[model samples]
Target chain A: MAFRASVVRLNRAIVYTQNGDPAQVLRALTYKPLPPPAPETVNIKYLLAPINPSDVNVVQGVYPAKPSLTSLVDGQPDVFVGGNEGLAEVTHVGSGVTDLVKGDWVVMTKAQAGTWSSSRNVGVLDVLKLPRVEGLTEVHGATMTVNPPSAYNMLNDYVALEKDEWVVQNGANSAVGQAVIQIAASRGFKTLNLVRKRSDIDELTRKLKDLGATEVLTYDDLNDRNLTQRIVKEWTGGKGIRLGLNCVSGPDTTSMARLLGQDAYLVSYGAMSKQPLALPTGLFIFKNLTSVGFWQSRWYKQKTRSDKENLFKTLATLIGHGKASPEHEIVTIPAEDSDEVAGQKVREIFAKIAEGQYGKKVLLKIAGSE
Target chain B: MAFRASVVRLNRAIVYTQNGDPAQVLRALTYKPLPPPAPETVNIKYLLAPINPSDVNVVQGVYPAKPSLTSLVDGQPDVFVGGNEGLAEVTHVGSGVTDLVKGDWVVMTKAQAGTWSSSRNVGVLDVLKLPRVEGLTEVHGATMTVNPPSAYNMLNDYVALEKDEWVVQNGANSAVGQAVIQIAASRGFKTLNLVRKRSDIDELTRKLKDLGATEVLTYDDLNDRNLTQRIVKEWTGGKGIRLGLNCVSGPDTTSMARLLGQDAYLVSYGAMSKQPLALPTGLFIFKNLTSVGFWQSRWYKQKTRSDKENLFKTLATLIGHGKASPEHEIVTIPAEDSDEVAGQKVREIFAKIAEGQYGKKVLLKIAGSE
Candidate 1:
C-alpha cells in the first residue's frame, strides 16, 4: 500500500430534513470538504455502516434520542445526518489526537454522531479504537458496539451465571439473540432459546445449535405445559432458568416468565411485537420474579471511556477467534454514485427490512476512493 | 363493666377439614376447654376477628400460605382453622410465660394460627402484645399486621419518599390503600389516590380525604391526558411520583405506570381485577419504570420477633395519635347459639361479602358465655 496524501476531500452525507418515513424524508447531499479536525478531534472516513431498528425509529421521530440538526454542512442548511453505528478508518489526526493515528480503525462509542457518510470529523473522545487483529472484519467491527454488548451485558449484568447454569431468551434468532447464545456458550452457560414458528423450523434450530444454543423451541412449544416441564426437567435437572431476556412482549413475555426460577429476572429490551408486556400476578407475588427494561443506548450513556474500550477489546478478541460474530448481508454503495442514486438504493433496502424480507442484518459498505 | 371470672371456659371452635368456599366448608364445634396453657403458652379469650380478602382466599385454598390440617383439635379430626387475624385478652398464662399477663391484649403475629374461636391456647411466640394505649380499639389491633405494614413497607422499602415527595396509589379506598394514605400523610408525603367509580363517588372521596388523602379521583380521570398531566404537575410540583402502589392490576396497572416519574417503581401487592398486569414498552424503555410484587406474608416470614413487635409498637403510637385506623364493621357471634344457627349466620355474612354488599370490613365478635 502506498502512503495516501493527507489532503482535503469532498464529503457526501445522507441527511433527513424532517421526521417521517425514510423513503419520503431522507435525502443524499454532497457538501464542501469537512474542516480539518479540531485540535482535540480526528477526521475519519467511514468504511461501513449498518441500518438499525432504533436508527429507523429515530428517523421516523418515535425514538427519544435525536440528533441535533443545524446549518453545519455547507449548501445543505439545517440538516441532520442519518446513522448511529459504523466502522471507520482514521484519515487524518488533529494536533491533540494522541491515542489514534492515520492508519487506525475505529467505531463510535457514543451514539448520534452521524456515521452514514463517506467522511466526517469527530472528537477522539467519541470513538474507540479497534485492535488490528487478523480476521476482525469491518462488518463485525461495524456491528459490535450495539448488539454484542447488549447480549453480553444482559447476561452478566443482573445475574451471575455459574457454568451449566441456564439463561433463557425469546427472539432467539434475532441479531442480539444469536450473539447471546454464542457468548453464553463460550462462557459455559446453557441457553434455552425460543423463537417464532417458521416453515424452516428444523433449519433454524440447527443453525442456532451451531451457534451454541443448548436447546431450541417455538412459541407453540411454550404453550404445551407437559413439553415445557419435560424440557425444564431434562435441561436443568429441575433448576430454574435464572436469567430471561425478553425482546418480544405480549403473551410471549408471560410464557417466558413461567419458566423462570425463584428470584429470577426477565429483562425486556425490545418490543418487536409492538404488544404490551403481560405478566401473571402470581409470578411476581409468589415466585419473586422481576420484570425490568434494558436499553443499550442508556447503558452506553452511563459507561466510562475506559469501560467501553475494554468491552470493545474483549469483543474484538472474540471475533478474532471466531467465537462471537453476527450473521450479516453486505450492500456496497459505489464511491462515484450520484447522491440521488445512493439515497434511492438505501431507501429500497430500508423498505425491504420493514417488510421482513431480509433475515440477516444489512450493512452499507462505502467504496472509498483509493 | 363487671369483673368476669377468669376460670376454665368451654371453648367453641370453627374449623375446616378441606379447602373450599368459606360458607360451604366452615363448621363450628363445641369442644372441651383447651388444655391448661403449657409452660411456654398462654390461654386467651378471643375479643374480635376480622374477615380479610386474603382470609377468604385462604379458605378457598388459593393462598400460598396454608395452615397444616392435623388432628390437633380434640374432637375435630384433621382440620385447618378458619381465621388469620384477631385481637384477644390473655385469660391465663403458663408457669414459663414471662412476658404476658392475665389481662394483656395481644394479637396473632404469624399467620394461620386459629383466631376464629371463643378461646384457645398458643405459645407466647405466636402473638405480639398490643401496647396498652388509651385510644386503642379491638378493630385496630385485630387488623394491624397485614394491611398497615403492607402500606408502610411498600412506600418505604422499594423507594425513599422524602418529605413533600409524591406517592400515587390505586385502590385508594381498599384497606391497604386507606392505610397508605394515612401513613404517607403522617410522614409528610403527599398522595394522589385512584379509585373505581361508584354511585357514592363523592361520599367515598370525602371519606378518603378525611383519612388525610391529598387528592382523590376515579379511574376515568386516569384516561384524560390533560387531567393526568395537570394533577402530576400540581401534586409533584415537577418532582416525579417516586412510589406507585398498585393492588388492582390489568389496565389499572398500565394507567398508574403512565403517571410514574423517571426511574419510578410500581409495586403490585394484590390483583382485585383478577386481570394480568399489562405495561407499555415505552414506559419501561424510556421512563425506566419497574414492576414488582409485594406479599406482606412473605415479609413477615423474613422479619425477626423484635422486628415484628417494633412495627406493631410504631403502629400503636400512630393509632393512639389518631394518625392510622382501618374502617371496620362488627358482628356479634353469640356463644350460646347452636352450631347449626351460628354456622348459618356466618355463611350469610360471607355471602354478603362475596356480593360486595359491605364497604367496611366485617369483624366477628364471639360473645363468649360469661
Candidate 2:
C-alpha cells in the first residue's frame, strides 16, 4: 500500500467517513497528493491546526456548521477532513496568483476548510496572506485566527465601550477569555472574569490576572450577591457593567448578566455548560438589556477579505507590541508515527478538549515533530 | 370637612405615600386646587387614564421607573400619583401658552407625570397637543400613548419586516397585541399570535383573527412541535417567523422563540408571567437569535416631541380610517364620587389588570360622568 501511494507522494489527512463519536469515526488516511494547483490556486502545507471545542461538536454532528465532504482521502467515496482553523505555509503557487508565493505564511479564510491535512491544494481565494509579525510563535499563529479575533471583534462589534468601562464574562479561563482579558486591558477597559471553582482556583485566578484580568472570580462567587454588588460599587462606582461575554451558559451566565446595566449587551459565543441561557425578562424590559451572539466563522463568511486581513493585522500588531498574546499548547504528531497512531492521538486530544480539562488551547502540529 | 375642602374647589389626585399593594398604599386625596398655571404652563383636566399593569407595579414600587414624589395630595409630605399615560383637555392655558388653547386635547409628554388626577397644573413642556383626528374615541386617544404605539413601534423597530413576513407574539389578546395584529395587517405583514388557553378560546381566537392575525395559537400548541412545524410548512411555506414579541416568558416564550428562523429577534415589552426569560444558549450562537427589549416610556423619553407627535398621528390616523380602534372599557367615576369610593374603584380595576382577568383595557373617566 505504501509503494502504491508513493507513485504520487502520499499525503495524510485526518478523516471521518461518518459523524459520531470522534474516537469511533476519525482516522488518518493516506492518499495520493494533489498533482498540482490549477490556476489561481496554491498547494499549502498545514503547519498547525487547533482543536477548538466547536470543532469537536462538528465531528459529533451537533454543531451548526457541517464540514464539507471530500473524496481525496484514501480513495474514499465520502470523507471529511477535520479542523476549522490553522496556519499554513505556501509550498507552490499556481499561475495567475500574484499575492502569495512559496514560503509565505497564511491562514484559511473559509469556514471548516479542512485544515487537519498535512498538505493540500487550495485556491487562492481560500487563503488569506498574513502580515509579517515579530516574535510570533506557531501556537499564536495557529490559534489566533479564531479565538483572538473572536475576542477582538466581540469587544468592538457590539458596544463602543468607553474607557474605564468594565466587561463581565464567564468561562474566563478559556483561550478566548484570556485574549479578551488582554485585549480589553490593552484598550484601557477592565475585565471581570469568571471560571469554574476548582481545587486549583487560586492558581487559575493568578494566571488569569497575569493575562490582564482586572478581577477573576469563580462560579461559586456568584452565590455572594453582596460580593458582586460590591464590585459594582467599588470598581464601577455605581455605573454597571455595559457588556458581558458568555460561553458557559445556565446559572453562571445568568449571574454574570446581572452585572449589566441599562442598554447593555450580552454576547454569547459558546454553550460550554451544554445548558440553555436564562435571564430575567425584567432585565430586557426594565434595564433595556440586549442579548446577541458572535460566531467568528460567521464573521469570516460575511466580512470582505480586506476586513478580515485588517483584523489579523490588528491582532498581530497587538501581539508584536506585547499587548496581547494567545495562550495555547501544541500537540505534535511524530512524523514516524503510523496513521493509526496519529488518528488515535487526534481523538484523545479532542476528548480532552471536549471535556475542557486540558489546561490551554491544544493545537495539532501534523507536519512532523519539532 | 366637605365645606372646608371646597375652599379652593378641591382637586382629587391619586396618592401613594408609601410603596406596597395598590389596595393598601393608594388613595384619592382631595387637596386645594392650584391657583393657576405658572408661565408656559396650563391647567389641564384629565379626561381619561388607563390602568396599565406597569402602573400597578409602579404603585407597588417594583418597576424600574419611579414616580416623582409630590406634596400636592392631601398636603402629604411625599405622594406618588398613579397613572403613566392619559388624555387631558387644556382647560386654562397659561399666559405665555400660544399653541394650546382651551379644550385642545393633549397627552402627557413626561413619563409618570401624575396623569391620574382630575386636574393638574402643568407646564406646556409636560403636555403634547393632539392632532385633529376625526372620529377618534376617548378610548383610542387616552390609551394610544402606551399600548398602540408600543405595538406599532415594536413591530417596526427591530426588523424591517416585509409584506407577508410573519411576526410571532405571546399575549395576543393584550391591547398591544390587538394593535400589533391590526397594524401588521394594515402594513401587509402577517402575525402569528399566542395566548393562554381559556374557556373561550374560540371567541378570543376569532376576535384576534378579526383583528387580522394570520393564526391564533395558545401556549398549549407549543407542546406539539409538529403542529408548529406544520404552521411553518403550510402557512409560511417553510419560512420561519423573523420577529417574536414576548410579553410572557419562561417555557412558553422559549417554545414561541423556537418558531423563529435564523438571525431572528425577540423583543420583550412586558413580563406578564412575572418570571425570567430563558432559552437554549445554542439558539443565540447557532441561529444568531437576538433578544432585546422595548419600553415605551424609554422611547418617549428619548424621542423628540415632533417624533412623538408623529407616532401619535400615525396611530390616530389608523384609528380614524377604521384600520384600528383601541379595545377598552370605561370605568367612570361619577362627579359626586367620594375620594374613598374613587380610590377603591381604581384599586379594584388595577387588581384585575394585575391578574390579567380584565377582558379589555379599563380606562378611568375621572373628570365626570356623561
Candidate 3:
C-alpha cells in the first residue's frame, strides 16, 4: 500500500485488436500510467479479474455484450480488453468523488468495461464499493459481481418461491448453478439439479446434495417417461416445478420444461449446448408455461445502485459465513513478466476455458506485467 | 321461439364413449330433455356450436380441456359430450334463476360443458347472458366466446401495444388470426401476418388484408434471411416487434421470435403445426424475450364473469357494427333426422376439420335429431 503512493507503475492490459480466436487475437500492451483521476472519475488497479466463458465469446464477437474499446495502449490504434467481472483497489479518487477513495475495494458495475487492464480511470458510477471485506477471499470478491447476483436475481425476480418450493435447473455444475443451489438452499427452497450425464455421476450427485440440493439427476434420467412422471407424482405430489433455470438448451431443456407445472416460468441465462430450446408449445399453452431469459448485465442496468449494494452486502454475509461457495482456480501473473509471456498466458488460459477444460472459473491474480 | 315455451322436446347429444378418431368414436344419443331446471339451473337449446379444431382434439382426447361427462344419457353408463363454445337460446328457466329467462340469448362460459347437446340443464354460473343479439349473427354469437376474446387478451395481456405499433402473427388464415387482425386494426395497430405457402396464398393474403391486415406474407418469406431482417430493420426502423402471436411452431416460430426486440413477448395460443417452438437461448437472455401461452379456457377460469361479459359486449358490439367478422361454415342438422345420420354427419365434419379442409370454422346448427 505504501509502495503504490511512493512509486508510479506502468499499466499493462490484455487487449484485442480484432475479434476472432482468443489465442490468436489477444495480446498484452504496455501503456503509460494514470496521472490523476479526472473529475467524477476514480483510478482503479484491478486486483483480480476472472476469465469467464462469456468473456471468450466477447472476444470471438459472438457474445451480445461489447467490450469497452480504447486507443490508449501505447502501440495500438484501438483495442478491447477482456474480462467483465473483477475485484479492484481504488488508488486515487477524482475531484468531487466522495463515494470512493484510495485503498477502497470496489467491483465493476459496467458490463465489459475492460477489467483485464491493470489500472484505468473510470466514472465512480461504473463501480460499486464493496463493504468491509475482512473475512472474504479475493476469489469470492472477484467472482461475486456476476454469477452470485445472477443467481440471486433469477430466484427473486421471476417467481416468489416459498420455502421448500422446488426449482429445476440444468447446467447444475456451472458456476451460477452452484450459486443458485446454495442461495435457494439457504432460503429453504428445494432444487432439482440436472446435469449432463458423466461417468462420475454418483460423485457429482453427492457433491450437489451436499450443497442442499433435494434431488440431483442427469439429463438422461429425464428420458425415462415413467421416472419423469414419478418425480412429479411422488416427490412434488404433482405440484410440479414452477421455476426452471436453463443454461443447456436442446431436447433435454424440453424435458426439463415438462417437469414444470401450469403457470410456471423457465429462465434461461446461457446456452452451454449452443442448441436451441426445443420446447413443445403445449407447455406454454396447456401448462401455461413461460420461457424467459436473464442477463446479469441487463439486471445491473435496470436496478438501482442501492439494490446492487444491498445484494452485495447480503451475498458477502452469506459467503463470509461459508454458506455460498464458488469454486475458482486462481492463475497469477507476476508484475515483472515480459509482455509477450504474460499475454500468452492469458490467451492460453482463455483458449482452455473456451474449450470448457477449465471446468471451474479461472481468476487472474494480476497487478501488471511491468 | 314460440314453441320453446310450449313444447317439451326430447334432448339429443353427440357423445363420445371413449377417445379416438372422432369418426370412429362419436355417437349421437337421444336422451330425455330437462324436466324443469334443477335449482339455479336453466334449460337451453344450443342454436349453434362451433366445431373448433380443439373440439376435434377433444373427441380425440388430445385437447387440454376435458369434456363434461354425463351418465344420464339413456343408453350409455357415462359419456363425454363434445363441443366447447356455443350460442344457445335459454328456455324453461329454473325457479332460482333470475339472470336468464326463456327466449334469452346466452353463451357458454364453461369449457367443454357438453354444448353439442340439443338441450340440457346448466348452472346459472356456467352461462353468460348475451346483452342483446338482434344485430349479431349466429356464427358471431357462437364463435365470439373463444377466438375474439383470445385475440383481445393476447394483445392486451402481454404488451401495452400503442396505436400504429406492429404485431406479428402466423396462421394468418385462422379464425383467431382474422379476429386479431380486426381487433388490432380497430385499435389503430398494424399487423404483419404470416401464413403457410399454399396454392391460394395470394388469395389468402388478399382476404386477410381485406380484413384489415397491414401486411400478409407466406411463411416462406421468413426463410429468406434478408427479408426477415428487413422486416425488422426497414419496417420497424429497428424498433422491432414487441408482441408476436405464434400458432405454427417450428423453425418458422424461431424466426418469428427473432423478429421481436429486447423485452418483447411472444404469446402463443395454439400449435397448429404440432411442432415444438425451437428458440435460441440468446433470445431470452440477451434480447430479454418472453414466450408464453394463452388458453381461452384458462382465461375463462381466471377472470370474473363480468370481465368476460365486458369482453363479450365489446366484441358483440364490434361484430354488430361490422368492425370484426369471423368466417364460419354453418352445417345444419334437421330436427327430425335419425340419430345414426346425425352422429355420422358430425363425425364426418370433424374428420374434415381434422384434415384441415374446413379452412373456415364449422358451426353445427342443431336442435337435434328428435
Candidate 4:
C-alpha cells in the first residue's frame, strides 16, 4: 500500500555536525516507509503541533527521553521523530479500538506519541479526546494540552490561591505564564508577572496587564538589592507573597525564594538556564519555605480520570467563553509533508524558543485549509 | 549580694586548645555571687541541664545563634552562663513577680535562658511549671522541652500519619528520631529508621526497636543502590513510602528522595554532616517530591501559645510515664564561670559534636553533685 507520506527514510536528520555551535546543523534526510500501527492502535491524520523547549532539548540530545536508532539503507538509523505533543483527527481505528471514531480530535496524553507525522498509529490509551470548543482552531487546541494544564495544576494542586491572594510567576510572556496570568485573573486572584527586559517593555507590560497581571516587572528590576523587600511592601501590604512559580532557575530563584512568606511554596517546572538552583539556607530555615518541582506530563499521568475530566471541563469552558486563549504564531505545512518538513520546522521554531525570541507559541499547522 | 555559686573566673575550661585532638577541656571553677533578680524576673536555682548537639554546635561557633559578648572582663568576658535549657527551683521572686512562687520547679521554656546557673533571673513567659512525676528527676525534666516538642510538631504538622502507614526517618538514635519512633509506635504507625554504623550496631538496633522502631538499619546497609527499590517492596508493599524525615543531608537525603512515593514530602530538620542537600531532578519531577527544611525554634515562635501548651502537656505526660527519654553523657560544670571560660567550654563541647565523636549528649550540672 503506497500512500503519500513525508518520510525521514535513513540515518539523516537536520544534523548538528559540530558541538557547542548552533550554525553547524541544517535539515537533510535519507529515505524509509512509515510503519503500520499495532493491533490496539489508531491511525491519526496530523492536525496541528507545537514547538516546545523539550523538543529542542531532545534535538540537542540533552533531554531525558532519547530516541532509539535503527538501521536504514546503509544499516544506519539516522531518522527519528522530534515533536512531543500535537492535535490529530482519527482516520482509522484498529481491530481492537472501541472508544475512538473517525473525525474525533485527540491529543497525545502520554509520552512517545510524536505528532510531527502526517499519519501515525498510536495506542488508544496514549491519546485523549480533546473537548471541543466552538471556533477553536487546531493550532490553539494543539498547544493547549501542556502549558495551560501546567499552569492550572500548579495553581490548584500546591496551594489554593484564594480570590484575594496573589500568585507570582516568571516568564510572564511565555505560553504557560500567559495561561497562568489569564486563569488567575479570571478566578479573581492577582498576578505578579516577571519577564526579561525586551525592547518593547512598555507594550509587553501593557499586554500582560490586559491579560490580568496586576504588576509586571523585568528581570533587571529584580536585580536591585531591595527589590524583594520593595515588592513585598507594595504588592502584599507587608504581608509577603504566598506562591512563586519559576521556570527560569539560577540566582533568580534565590531572589524569588526570599520574597515568599512563611510556609509559602515555590514550584519550579523548568530550568531554562540549565543552571543549578542555589537557594539560601536562611529562607528554608527561618521562613519555612518549601521548594518544590513540577513536571506537567508526570502530574497528568498521576491524576485520576475524574481529575482530568474536571480540568478538561473547566479549561474548555474558559476557552469557549473566550476567558483564556493562547497567543500562538501558526506556520502552516501541507498534510502530505508533515512528517519530513514539520520536524525540521519544529526544530527551527525550538531554536528560536531556546534563544528566547518568541513572544507566543510557534505552532505547525499540519492539516490542509478547512 | 553573695550568692553561693561554682564559677570559672578566667579563660581555663575543658580547653581542647588543638584541632582533631581529644576533649581535654574539663576543669573546675571558683565560686562567685550573682546579681539580684530584676523587677520583672524570678531568681531560679539550677536543678538540672542537658547537653544538646546544638549546644555543641554553639561551642564550635557553627551554630546560627551567637551569644552576645557583653559580660566580658578585662580583654575577655569574665563570668557567663552556658546552657540552653534545664529544670530550676524558684529560690526567690522579684518585686513584680506574681505568677511564680519560691520552691516551684520550672523549666526554661525560651531558647536563650542559660540554665547552668545556681540562681538566675528570667521572665515569667520564659518558664513553664513542671508537673510532678514520681520518677521524673531534675535531670529527666531538664531535657524535656526541645527534642520531644520538635518530634511531636514535625510529625503532626506535616501529613497526619494514619494507622498502618509508614514513616521513615534518618538519624534514628538522635533525640528527635527516638521521640518520633515512640510517638509513631504509640499511634500504631510503623517507622523505618536509618543510622550510621557504630561499634554497638546490634545493641543500638535492639535499643531503637525496643523504643518502637519497626526496622533499624545502619547507613552502610541503606547505601545500597537498590535500597530504595527494596524499601518500596518491603515497607510499602510496593505502594511507596509516604513521609520521610531527614536530619542527615548529602547522599542520605538523595536516598530518602528516591524512596518516597508520588506527592511524598521530605522534611529536613538538621544538617549533622554540614553538607548541602543534593536532590536529583527525577525525584522532583517524576515522584512529585517536596523538599522542606525545618527549624524547631522558628516553628515554636510561629505557633500559638495554646498549641505550645498542648504539645508541652502531651510531651510531659509521655516523659512522666517513661515512654520517651533522651540518652545523655553528663558533664558537670560549675554554675559560676567567667564569661570567657564558660563560652570556651561550650565551644569545645560543640566542636566535639561537629566531629561526630560523641555518641551521647554532654550535660552540665550546676550547684549540685555530678
Each prediction's Cα lDDT score?
0.83, 0.83, 0.85, 0.68
Q: Where is model 2 chain B poorest over a 10-residue stretch in terms of lDDT?
A: B1-10
Candidate DockQ values, in order, are 0.69, 0.78, 0.89, 0.27
C-alpha RMSD over true interface residues, each candidate: 0.9, 0.9, 0.6, 2.7
In candidate 4, which residue ranges exceed 4 Å CA deviation?
A1-137, A156-166, A184-226, A229-239, A273-278, A295-370, B1-46, B51-84, B89-135, B160-166, B181-224, B298-360, B365-370
Query: Which candidate comes out best when scored by lDDT?
Result: 3
RMSD of each: 2.6, 3.9, 2.2, 9.3
> Clashing residue pairs, candidate 1?
none
DockQ ranking, high to low:
3, 2, 1, 4
- Residues A1-370, model 1: lDDT tens digits: 2225564455677788889988677877766666667898988888889988888999999898898884646565689888899999888799967899997999997678788887888889889899978888888889988888888889888898899898999999999898899889889999999999989999999999989999998988899999878766877787668799989998977888878877788888889899999988787887777778888888888888888888888888876676556667888877687888878888888888888898778887755444
| Native contacts, share recovered per candidate | 0.62, 0.84, 0.97, 0.37
User: Ten-residue segment with the worst summed lDDT in candidate 3 chain B?
Assistant: B1-10
| Candidate 2, residue B31: lDDT | 70
lDDT of 1 by residue, B182-210 (tens): 88899999888999988999998998889
Q: What are the runs in model 3 whose C-alpha is more than 4 Å off?
A: A1-3, A71-76, A323-325, A354-357, A368-370, B71-76, B323-325, B351-359, B368-370
- Given candidate 2, what's the lDDT at residue B89? 80
Minimum summed lDDT over a 10-residue window in model 4 chain B is located at B9-18
**Chain A TM per candidate, in order of listing:** 0.95, 0.91, 0.95, 0.81
Better of 2 and 3 by DockQ: 3
Write the residue-wise lDDT of candidate 2 on A145-237 in tens digits. Answer: 788898999999999999978999998988788889989989999999999989999898888888789988888888899987988788888
Q: Model 2, range B1-370, lDDT digits (tens) per residue?
A: 0123234455777778888998677887777666667889998788889887788888888788888888784544878888989998877777989989887889887889888887788889878887768888776778878888889999988899998899999988888888899899999998989999989999988878887899888999988989989877877788778899999888899899879888899999877787788898878887889999898988988899889878878888886665556667888776578889988887787677767787667787665322
